[model samples]
Each structure stands twice: as C-alpha cells, then as structure tokens.
Target chain A: MATGWKYRTAEAETAEAIDRRCEPRRPLGLRFALMRIRVETELCQGHGRCYMLAPDLFYADDDGYCHPTGERTVPAELADQARRALMNCPEDAIILTEET
Target chain B: MTDAKKYSLEPPEVARNPHDTYREIRDNAPVAELAGRSQTGAVTLSRHEDVMRAFQTPEVFSSDPGAIEIGNIRPLVPLQIDPPHHRKHRKALDPLFAPKQMSKHEPRVRELIRDLIDKVVDQGHCNFHDDIAEPLPSTIFLELLGLPVSRVDEFLALKDGIIRPPARSMEERQEKVKATGQKIYAALEEVVEARMAQREDDFLSTLIDAEVEGQPLSRDDVVDIGYLFFLAGLDTVSASLECMVAFLAQNPGHRQRLVDEPEVIPHAVEEMLRYESPVASAARITAIDTEVNGCPISAGTRIQVLIGSANTDERAWDGPDEVDFDRESKKHIAFGAGVHRCLGSHLARMELRVALEEWHARVPHYRLADGLELQFSQGIRQIDNLKLVW
Candidate 1:
C-alpha cells in the first residue's frame, strides 16, 4: 500500500524522518536541521486537525482558520511536532521544509 | 441523451445514487459547468485539489451567496457569512459542542438509540432509517435547540425540504426550498423574541442572552444563527447514520469486524464517512476573478465543491473508492474545510460512533431485507427507507 500522509519538500528526509525519534527529549547532543512550517492558506480548509492535534506548534485564528502564529521557524528540537502537524492537515495545505 | 445532458442534481428516482454521476464528471470533466438554465453560472469542482483550494481561499471563493441552501443571500449566520463575521459567529457557537456537553449527553444518546431499537427488535424486521437513523439525530438536536418534543415531525419536514425537496421544476423547487427556509427562520424569530422576554435553559435561549463585540446580538443575528443550526444540525447526522447502516448491512465481513472488535468502531465510522459522505457539494460564490485548475472563473461565479468526489479522489487517498477501515490517516473533507467548516462536526462524530456501537450491541447480525431497495435522497445523499432484517 502507498505509505502515510506527509507531503514534504525535496530537501527533507521523507522516509527516514517518519522513523526518527523526536519525542521532545530535551538537551540534544548533536546538531538538528532547522525546519519551516507553513500553511498555503489558500488550500487550508481549517479542519483544526493541525492546530487541535498539535497545539504546541499551532493555534487557530480567531475565525478558526489557519494557525499562523508563534515562531515561523522551528528549532531542531521541535521538528517532530512540525512533522506531526504536517501529516495531520486534512487539506494537505501544510508544508514542511528543512534548511541545509 | 448523454450522461451530462441527463444529469440533474435532483432527479426523481426510487433508487438513484448520484456518486456514479459524480465519478463520471470527476474523471472526464473535473471542472464541469452546471447544465441547466437554473444552475446558470454554477460550476462543480470534481477534483480534490481544486475543491480544497476553493474552500481554503474563502477570500476568493466566499460562502456568502449560500453554502448549504442556495440563494440564501440574506446571510445565515456563520454558515453563509464570510470571515470576520463568520469567525465571531463560530467563536460563539462552536463551543456549544464541547466535550463536556457530549460526555453529559452521550449516555443519554445511547439510551435513546437502545429504546428506539427495542421498539422494533422483536418484529425481526424494520425500516432502519425511520426506526432509528432518521429520528435519533433530530431528536437530540431539537432537544438541544429546546424545540418542543411534540413538534418533531413538523421540524423534520422543514429540515428535509431544505436538503432534499421533491424533484420538480427549478422555479417550483427553489420556491419550496426557500419557503421551508422561511418557516424555519420565522420559527427561530418567534423563539428569539420570546427568549428575550424571558430566558430558558435551551441553547437558543443562551445564545439570545449572549454577547459578541461586548454588545448583545440583534434578533436577526440570533435568529439567522438558529436558522442555520436548524437547517444544518437537523438532518445531517441522521443522513450519515442511515448511510453507515446501509453499508454495514450489506458487508458481513466488515460488520463482523465491528461486532468482534468494538474498539475499532470509531476508526470504522471515519472510514464509513469517507466512503459515504452524507452531503455532496457545498456552494461558494467567487468573490474575485480566480482560476481553478487553470480554468478562469469570473467574479460572482457559483462554485460547487464536489466534496463527495473529493473524498474519493485518487490523488488524495490510496484507494479512493475502497472502504478500508484500517487505512492510515483517514482525514477526509466530509464535514468540509476552513472557517466555514461544519460547526456540528464534533456532535456528528459522537452520534455516528455511538449509534454504531449501540446498534451492533443489540442487533449485530442484521442484514438488508430481501427484495427491498435502498433509495438515497438526491440532494443530501440520505437513505430514507432502508429495510433491514436479522
């Protein structure tokens, strides 16, 4: 069967990232990739899956639309959460990109 | 006549399933125009990406003209109003479906389902929709709205008319649909005025007494909001329940799975909803000139997002047409997307899940009554008289 729902950019490790353990264990010993989370607001249907499912990284608009608040870029420590929100988005409107 | 020529959103038939037509358009003409004089400037987005894009960009594709009910141009609260106003309405209304409310009422909902099933269980046969699916959701919703229990049938008629009116001339059907809407609106208006005089414990009374923008809402605001709830919350859950049951009765393997492993019912419900989306397309008016899938659409154009087709779009799902309860990531736009998404989604999910659990506990072995037919409503895609026997 076709694998899971994450729609990622070319640079991010698509298959390997799904297996990576990023359970928010503080004090990383090694360097982590910088991640950027975005909602192609035009494609977001505001299902609240992204915000409701991943509250730490997302909060809904007053209109219950996109959660475009807080640090637009996430530290390596929070990359797992950003990925969860990426998979959770029903509209597939949420995109995740990692900076080299 | 060709399929396109013969296609009517509301055609008169005993056992018509419009999804077959939806599939035809989705494959050949993903952005097909409405074929009649009545549907004039309307276009349906059969592709999933296009449907998602239209709703996600509400600034360009507004629900103001009407989302659920057509030409309801007067703005039916959050349902028909675009954002800013729509957000405020949702802020006030969305919390009503809080988990606390469901925790308090779900046991009661389960009891209600059992009692209704008990009435027909001994007969060894029953019309499933009328017996349980048709009445359960409406009963719970009306009780929430605090509408009198004695007037269930009356409100049921009004709700059904808005969603699935009898197939007739475009002018005639539109007239009936609007008139039904007016009756609902007038009912809310009367209640809002009365509640203003003296409050009650019902949701409507609370809404009447509530404030937005640090100012009390006008009668129109409360009434229109209530009217939208009446039209939306009334028949949608019931329609979904009916659809779920119809599918279960025919597929013994899936039915047995649910009965054997009750814990999977919630996931099963999501799969059922994805496979059989109760509502089809929701309407949006183009607020500005836009292009969907490269097809240029002018401002004021009516875009009907084919939600049913989008759920089954191969571009999104692994096997879009197959019903896989165990499938990973079952996120479908059955309730819609964006700020104008279905406000009653939480309630609908609870009801569908509870209904499945309670029914299987009692009548786990029921099957479609032999020689009987399953006829789904054209507009809302609901089964009215699904006969089942154990």
Candidate 2:
C-alpha cells in the first residue's frame, strides 16, 4: 500500500517536463523568436554583389558563386541593410521571414 | 594587327570575337610577346599545351607580380605569392574551403538559390546582373567575413574602385584605389579588434587567433588575406556565373540538356569552365631562364598564360569552342594548377552547380533580351548587364 504521493527532487525534472508543466500558465510574449533568409539558386547568377555588400551575411564559392550563412541573427542596426540586400538582388534570390 | 608586332596588353579585347582573334594568333604566331606600360614585355602562351605547362610548373612561371596590375593597391595574398611561401598561406586556409567542408553549407546555398529563382519566375523578365549575380555573392562574401551587412554599399564601391576603376587617368585611378584599400583595411582592422575582444565563434575570430610558427599573424597579414578572400571569392565566381547564364540564353539546346538531365550539372560546369573561362590570362615572372614552345625566355621576364585560349585550344579539346556538356575528356585551367591553384575550387564548383541546377529547374525557357548592350572590363571577363526574359 502506498503511504501517499511520491516526492521528486528538483534535479529529477527534465527541461521538457518543466516546459510541459509550465506551458499553459506562461504568457506567449516571453517566448523567443527567429528569422531567416531564403535564396533561390535558379535566379542567382553568382554576381557576388551580396558578398561585396554584406560580407557578414553572405559568402561566395571558388567560382565567385554566392551562398548565405546559416546563422541569420541580424543585429538591430543591420536589419535594414540585410533587407536591402534581399530586395536588391538582381536575381531576386533572397527571401526574408520571421518565425515565432 | 600585324603578325610581327606585339599585342597591346591594355584594353582587353572583350568586344572582339575571341575565336577569330584566337585563330589568327594560333595560325600566325602561337607564341607572341605582349607589350604593356608597367612591364616592358611578356611572352603570351596561347596554345593549350603551352598554357598548361606554364601553369603547372609554378617554379618556372611565378604569379609574384600579379596576373594583371590593379593600380596602387597591393596584390592580394596567395594569388600574388609564388610557390613555397604561397603554399604555406594556402595550407592555412585550404581546410576551410575543402569540398567536404563546403558541402556542409550546401543546404543554405540551395535555399538562397531557390528563393532567388522564385522571385523572377513569374515576372519572366529581369536584369540578371542586378537581380541575381551581383547581389548573391556580395551578400555571401559579407556573411563569410563576419562583417556588417549594412556596409555592402561601401564594400561594393570599394571593390569597384579596385576591380573596375573609372575611365580616368592612371593617377586618378590610383588615388581612388588607394583610398578604397585604406577603407577596407580599416574595416577589417575594426572587425578584428571587436572579435578579439569578444572571442566569438566566427571565421574572423578564428583567423585572429590563428598562429603560424608560434606567432600570430600581423594586422597587415590579416588585412591582405581578408582582401584576397573577398576579391577572389566575389569577382571571379560572379563573372563565371554571368558567362554561364549568357551562354545558356544563347544556346537553347544546351540549356535544355541541363534542364532535362540534372545529373549532368557537374560535367556541365566543367564544360562551361572550359568554354568561357572568366580569368582569361594570368601573369607569371620567369623565375629562371626557361624555354616555352621552343622560345627562350629570360629570368624576370613576365609571361601571360592565356587561360581562355588554352580552354579553347583545338589540340586539347574536341569542338572546344562549342558548349558540349557531354565532353568525355574535359581538363581545364579555369581554377589554375599546382600549388597556386585556387583554394576555393570546390566551393566555386558547388556554387556553379547549385546555380545552374536550380536555375534550369525553375526557368526552363529563357532568352537574352534583344539589343541588350554587353559591356566588358579589362583583367576580368563579365557582362556588365545581362537582361533576360523567360
């Protein structure tokens, strides 16, 4: 026969379990968000203008081909510039999106 | 042009039909001397065998004085360094650009390529240079260097000043180029300083911490290497892609082949590199007196290896002028050779493959806009404006 209820130590709970228990009560505004840029290769001619303009967000291949970096965490000041790079691509290869 | 006279090195014959000129040179004089302002004269190796031999033997032909003059700005690293020393610098950076290492970034590259294609797939009309080629690599370069994306305009202007100097006096061009170099140097310095303070996980930070022989690289070394990576990664690849697109627009059948058989992209890329080499010529100083194609060359003599001509040489390739994606024996000097071979070769191939694959997959039919004026600059072969309609 069970005496009553089981007592679990603080260390016994996993992050997922804590999240599941607190999810319903927590407010949505406190959650972290993410944003990303998408590139369409068919449109890209590898002009490398993006690389020239935004060395931080773009890189090129040995043949002067262009590709985006994985981490798209734009700084507050650089958001507008990143957007411009996306908008100005001669190939229209870049697409920007935000996710919650 | 008379057969006896040397070819003027200035104002590269971008507009002239390259094939006709190449044929004339090949028939009249396979090896001719090139006269330029800075260097008195250099032997021009036009035939494929000669060019291949010259590029392969770096000890004999050195890329020390640069393939072409870029006014006042110092020549970028690795590209300007001859063997031994060049190998050391290349060794330091090669691992970062290996095929397997670059493959890790493929998904991101594919994503960029796809998004770019989607934008103009519906429009059916777009200026490819402005819409695609120019921006894609520019953005990519910035991201790799860990610089501020906001400074792209500044970067473009500086790169243009160096790569495409305004049609002005030499002195004026030199002044502008020097200023541009200083700006780039300052920017790189600032990035290095900031990264050192924060010690973040980025390429810039890694470079800052990189040591050679138990000593960290000097500020100038960092700046020079950074400059090389920027220019090499940006301009050459961009120009090659532009040429590829232009060729596809002109040759519907070849373009259709790529569309129908995506598996042939890698081979197709090799063929394109052979057909339209962006780097037309590279200069090398004769380290020792050497004889090329039976002509004796003295030490210190500059030699211009015509890579574009080599790609089209009749002896090396069948129907070399034609864009045959199915060519069985396709070996090209597009990425150069030996110790000085491009460190980013794999990266360049991946980019080209992805660009061609995604482009053909989306826009199955496209044509160059009629009456579109094509402008070509010296030292680099790239279309200034490429208007397209699909």
Candidate 3:
C-alpha cells in the first residue's frame, strides 16, 4: 500500500489542475487529489489484467504488455477502475498513486 | 535445520481431491519432500508466498532441461529458457496469442462448442468429457497449428502418451514418454518441413519467419517452440473445461446461478480455475542453493510448486475452500506466474467463458450421474468419464 506520494512538491500543482479539468464533477473547494496510474513493466508479466479491467486507462502492446493509454495521471472518475486493475493484477505490477 | 516431511502425490485420492492434502502440507510442512514419484531430492512448495517467491526468482529456481522430464531432447523454447532470451522469444510469440488476436477466434470457438452441444443436448445424459470437453480445444488447437483436424485423435493420443503415460514405474514412464516424444518430434518435423517449403497463414508458418535479437529463428527453434505449443494448446483448456463442467454438474445451486445470470460465468470460471487448478503443479530445478522457510535445498534439487495449494492457501484467502464468484480480487496463479506463465491464458479463458454461456443456455439443469465417482487423471486432472444427466 505504499502509494509513492513522497515526492509531491514537483507535480502536485500541475496534477491538481489536470484533475480539475478532467473531473469537473469534483466539489469546488473541499479538496482535490491527483491520482496517477503506472505499470512496472519489469514486474509486469503481461498478465493483461490491467488492460482487461481498465480498458480506458490501459492498452496492451503487441507483446500483451500494458502501457498507459491516455495519460499516466488518472482522473477521479477512473480511480475506482485503476484500483480494480491494481488489486487484480497477479504480479502486483500496477502502481497507483495519489498526489495531494 | 528442520527435516523435510514426506508427502506422496501419487495416491488416487489425492488426484481426485488434492486441496485437503495441500492444506495438510501447508500447515504441517510448507516444504515437503515428494515421495512415491521415485524421484529423489524433490520437494513440493504449498504456501502461496513461497510459491510466488519461487516463480519470481527463476534465476535460483531455474526451468532448464533438468527441471522435469517431458521427453524433450532440448529445452522447450521460451519455457525452459531463462530471462533475456526468454523475453525475446515471448516478444515474437505473445502477439500471436494476445487477447485481441485470440478474440478473433471467439466466433469459431463458440460455433464449435454449440455444434458439440447440439449433438449431446437431445440425449438425456452425455459423457461431457469425451463428448465435448476433450474434442473442443484439441480441434481448435490443431487448426491453429495448421495441422490436420482429421488427425486430432492421433495428436491427442500422442499428447496423452507423454502426459498420462500408463506406466507403473518411473523408468517405464520415461521410456514411454521418450518413445512418444520421438513420434511427436517426427510429426512436428514433417509439418515444419512442409510449412518451410510452402508457408501457410498459421502459427507454425508465422514462427518460421519470426526473429529473436535481429536473427530469424532457426528451424530447430521453430520446432522447439511448436513442441511447447503442441502440448500446451491441446490439453490445458480441455482439462479446464472438464473440471468446470464436472463441478457445475455436482453443484446445482451454482449451475442455476449461471443459468439465471450469465454475466457471472467469467467470474465463476476464475473461481473454479483456482479451486480445481487443472495444471496443478509446475516443476522447476534449483540452479543454486536455495532455502524454503529455513529448510536448505541444494543446487539441482527438483521443486514442484503446487499452484492448486497456493490458490487455496488460508494465508491467501478468508475462506480458502469456498468458491465465491463475487470476490473483489480473484488473482490466482492457476496459469502460473512470472515470465513463464501460460501464454494461451486469454484463449483458454475465452473458450471456457463461451462454453459455459452456451451450455447453461441450452442445458441449465444437470447433475453428475448418480453413483458415479469421477476419476480425474493425475497431473492434468482430465475426467475422462465425466457423465452428466439432466
């Protein structure tokens, strides 16, 4: 469950702006956390679970290995799906992070 | 150092229901010496964590030729090759079996399954194994390999000769597998030679032109890759179909659910694959000294990672024995883990899902023939006489 949010000073502002644009449904002032999705290609055995579960966020290469589809950063709307892919990957290869 | 406990995997009962023995081994001895197989210095790892560790650390737990004898003269391509080289071969092969590529076969697979069901539906009872399970995947596999579908029986016989050799002793088993291996090689050679002379739009011809590290694969490499696929593509899905259908026939409640809500068939297939892992154990050998839970294992020792055990280990699940389709996380190493995981998984999953969907739609109410005890063959777990009645 190490979300890898330690180095947040650099990308946090830009991530928040992207999240607001992608997820306008988010309440105006309460809080905004930018989510990121990544696949550790080395650990990924091309199980294809990430692409199988979260098609919008991931697509498989010719080798069946996963690559982020649109952007590495996730919108709030797709957070549940990103988590689903992370949880179901047998290799535990999917990395999900939240930037505050 | 803790002495390794002895566990026998040869008992008929164990083959019928291995989870109980797996549970005992995990609780009492996570790493137990495999007895009764007539193989020395062999051990079984039953714990999920240990199994995963062994798979991930293939540098220590190597899958070279010495791992287990399947009567191949050389290490099967991609499967026996360690990383770097293995990655290259897989890169050339994975795309051919990728989900998108496999999805193209969905229509054919469904049509085949429906055709098989058509022959059996009118009958009050049918030997689901012999009638549907065995033929479906083998036919598809033969077609994929560009081999003659008319020769499926011959190919299946050759496959069974190696997998379920009807021998009482290890020497006899090896001898039989070796002889059968020669026949398989000759058969593959004939096909590869023909394909080389006149290429076709199939897996064999594709592999002929495939490259690894900027060089086209040698003829031997193509044959070696075909050898692996010949065994893999024919058997695993068939065994899975047999296991799943047998389970459903016995469990009326679960079957009714599939009939009621077809969307759940995929999840149900995942659960059954975990519960009755058809390819129960995967073999490896130690390239260097290794230890399992503090027990020392020297180099060259044989290891059998019990995927069935890991799928049901209490340490890995809340109720390990229960089969729940609603599980939020259904991750299991039934197809195996690491780089050598089964390459045909997507094809197998699609076939299973479609077969179940069509079967439940046609014959929703069925059960195991009364007084029949399913005799699942060891290793692959195919129930040759899985009769069911509606």
Candidate 4:
C-alpha cells in the first residue's frame, strides 16, 4: 500500500511539472506583457461583443464565455485589438495587469 | 424601520418624487417585500449594501425568468445563467464590446448622434425622446448588430411592449409580449440564418461559429443571445441619455461646464449613471439562506436589487443625490457589480460621452418646455417626454 501511494504521488508531481513546462509562452518584452485581463465567470452575461471584436485573439470556449488564444506573442498589429477586447468587455470582467 | 415594511415595489405616482420614496425605503427598510399582484411576486433591496451584496452573489440572485416577463422569450445569453456557465458565455462575447473595439464604431456613433441632434437643434423645440433619445441608441444598436436599419420602428415597438406593457390585464400584457417577442425572435432567426449562409464578418457570423466547451453554439442559442443584445442594449442607454439631458437642462451651470471643458464629459457620464441608473432593479434568487446586513433571508427568495436607490445611498457616497461630475471615488452600482455587471458598460459610456461632448459643443444651451408634463415608466424612472430647446 505504501509503495503504491508513493508511485501515485510521484506520478501526480510529474504531471504537474510537465503542465508547468508546457504552458503557452507569454509575449516577451511586450509593453503590455504584464497586463492581466481577469474575467469574472459569474457576471459575463455573454453579449458576445468581445468575440465579435477580436475573433483571432479571443474565442469563446464551448461554455459560451471567452478565453484568450494560446499565449502567442502579442504582435504589434494586434495590440490595439487586444486593448479593445479588454476594454469592451461589457461586464468589466476583464482586468489588465501590469507585471512588475 | 425594517426594509420589510417601508416600500412598495409599485410607487405611489409613477413620475412623482421617486427618489424620495426610494430614500424612505432605503432608510426605513433596506429589504422590503413588494407585494406583487401584477408581475412576478418579488421583494426589493433598496439599500446600497443590500443591493450591492445581491449583485455580488448571483447564484442566489439569478437574472433569469427574464428581468421583465415578455412571454416565451427566454434569456439564453450569459446574464440569465449562474456562474461557471455564465463565465463561458461572457468570455465568448467580451471582445465585441471592448472600448477599443467600440472606437472603430465611434465615428459612426458620433455621426448618428450629430444627425439626430441636427434634426431638432434647428427646430429649437422638440420632444427629446421621440426626436433624439429614442432613435440614437436604436440606430447604433442596429448598426452594431448588423441588422437592417429599416426595422428600427418594429424593434422599438417590440421593446416598448416588453419594457412597459400597456395591455390592461396581465393576460393581455403576456399576449402582447408573446406577439412582439415572436416577431423579434423570427427576425433574429432569419438574420442569423442569412448571416450563417453568407458567412459574413459581422456579429451574427461570429456568434454562429463561436465554440463553447469545444462545440459551436447552437442556432437557437445564437438567436437567444441576439435577442438579449437587441432587447437590453438600446433602451437602457436611451433612458440614461434622456436623464442626462434633462438633468443638464435643469442645471445650466453643469451644461456650461461641459461646453467649456469637454474633457469632463467622461466623468460626467459616470455621474449621470450613478445619479439616474437606466436599468433599475435586477432580479436574483438566493441559492442558499443568507444573512444580509442583519436580516436573515431564506433560500429561493426573489430579491430585486434597486440599483438606482443604491447609487444614492448616503452611506456609500457623499452628497449622494447631487450629480457632481468631479466626484472622486465615484464607484457606483449603475452597471452592477461582480460577474453580472453590464457587459456594454464601456460602449454605453463611450456613446454618452461623445453625445454630451458633441451636444455641448454644438447646442450649448437648452431648457425644458414650459407646462410639459414629465412621465415615468414602471421599470425605469426618468423623464419620459423631455421637450428641449436650444
């Protein structure tokens, strides 16, 4: 039982480490790199304007709420689109975060 | 006095001194059970803290059953659903209304506002609601949704039926609501189908292809979402705009302030929203028995969060009744709070900001026509017929 428990714990830790390493690469040296858009799951009311404005960057997952496209570097051309997506969120669910 | 006894959801006179009645309720009974023989039987939370708390916990306060019943038209979008589910829908649509996204349409919104204002600025006398307030937001909404401009009248008529039912009896009201809702639903269904077939770059197409939980949203889901956007988008903004204009007319000093310093318009819009909230009470059902303030509320009790009243609470704000454009720390419940806050808040703000800036730049001075009786509807409390002359 002890050996089996140890094996299970090791497997869980290995999986978590892999997830951490495989996480999408955030934009590097981006001006708004630290800007975090926090989405409040509860308040979204889903008017769909966010997806309508920036389809390439933001897509609604199957549940009908928006999620950012995998961490691709914010291209210079799409920065404005990102800003619009952040600001236009009707529920004010998106919050911009600046990393120190 | 407990909120349980002080206020009736139905005010004494629809138009007369609503603020005072609200104040009475807020001070006397923060959460008063409003006897409902008319619409859905529900209670009201008039105090700032109480209303704020209700919005904060949406699981207990669902925005479902449609804010005001309009027959079979169920709210299919994010607002009606509880958390987890609500989050997904909100995420899917947030980008469309972002401030930057709205900037692309700013020029058009300004043009529409200018055109509407131009029609009556010269007349020097016109019903603000009919000539300007009603048309401006409706036009903008149609344009944004990529709907046909010609359907504006039909949309407005249907909106009115749902918002302020004129049918003599509840049954009549329900029937009218059903008829109007059916028209809107059918129109939306057709628009969605056409957009899907054409595969255009509009909101409809985006919604058609949007995936949730790895699956695209259903066609019926798209219609329900569109219906919410159509119904809630225009009227709320128009009402708020009407209130802003009326307040400015009554206070020429503030009007002059905007004319002199247009930069203050954004802040001024915040003040107006706080002063006269367009969307009044949003409904929520308690998921569990909760204690708010000191009162114990049972699970499943319907609570109506009176946003307008909460915005004026002296506890949260200083000189709460006065519309001070420069008020620092102007956090308000006008757009609601937590996850269920208004999604189009930024767009609505932009529209109002531009409208005020342009109006003050052009018209400058205006007044209410003498002997004109101001009116108020059930859900919204503001001047129904504002006659302005510049």
- Best candidate, DockQ: 3
Rank list by lDDT = 3, 1, 4, 2
Listing every candidate in turn, what is its Cα RMSD in Å to the true structure after a full C-alpha superposition?
Answer: 6.1, 17.8, 5.9, 11.4
Over B1-390, each residue of candidate 2 has an lDDT whose tens digit, in order, gives: 224354443544533236656655666667777544432466677887787678667788877654455532655676788756775666567657755466777787788878888888899898887777776666666777787778877777777777877755656766776777787777778988888788765567767877765678776677778887766766877787888888889888888888987877776787788778777777787889888767777888877777878778887777887777655444566776545667676777778888888888888899999877666555567677789997
Ranked by lDDT, the better of candidates 2 and 4 is 4
After TM-score superposition, the amount by which residue B98's alpha carbon in candidate 2 deviates from its true location, in angstroms, is: 0.3
Output the better candidate (2/3) by TM-score.
3
What are the per-residue Cα lDDT tens digits for candidate 4 across B1-390? 143543555653633346777787777777666544452445678887777667766666667664446544666587777777887787678777765576677898899889987877777788888887788888888877878879898888777877776878788888888888888888888999899888776788888889987889999888888888887775888888888888888899988988997877766787788887777777777777877767777876777788888888888778888878766534676877777777787678778888888788878988889876667666665456788876
* DockQ versus reference, model 4: 0.04
**Residue-wise lDDT of candidate 1 within B1-390, one digit each (tens)?**
013544456553522555666677777777767465445557778778888888788899898754344424378887888876776767777667644355468887988898998999889999888889878988888888877767889988888777767756877778888888778777777777787898888888888777887788788888777877887878888888888888888899999988997877877887788888887778888989888766787888777788888888887778777888777655788898776778777678778888899899889999988877778875467787799999
lDDT of 3: 0.83
DockQ of each: 0.21, 0.01, 0.29, 0.04
Q: Whole-model lDDT, candidate 1?
A: 0.73
What's the C-alpha lDDT at position B17 in model 3? 82
In terms of docking quality, model 2 is: incorrect
Candidate 3, residue B298: lDDT: 91
Show the lowest summed lDDT stretch of 10 residues, model 4 chain B: B1-10
| Model 3 C-alpha lDDT per residue in residues B1-390, reported as the tens digit of each score | 234445666687888888888898888878877667644667788899999999999999899989888889988998999986898898888999887788789999999999999999998799998889989999998999888899999999999998889998888999999999999999999999999999998999998988778999999999999889989988899999999998888888888989998877877888899999999989999999988898888999888898999999999887879887776666888999998999998889889999999999999999989999888887788898898999
Ranking by TM-score: 3, 1, 4, 2
The digit string of per-residue lDDT tens for model 1 on A10-78 reads 122421342233333333453666576667875665565665445455654544454553235665666
Q: Which residue pairs come into collision in candidate 1? A: A45-B337, A45-B338, A46-B338
DockQ of 1: 0.21
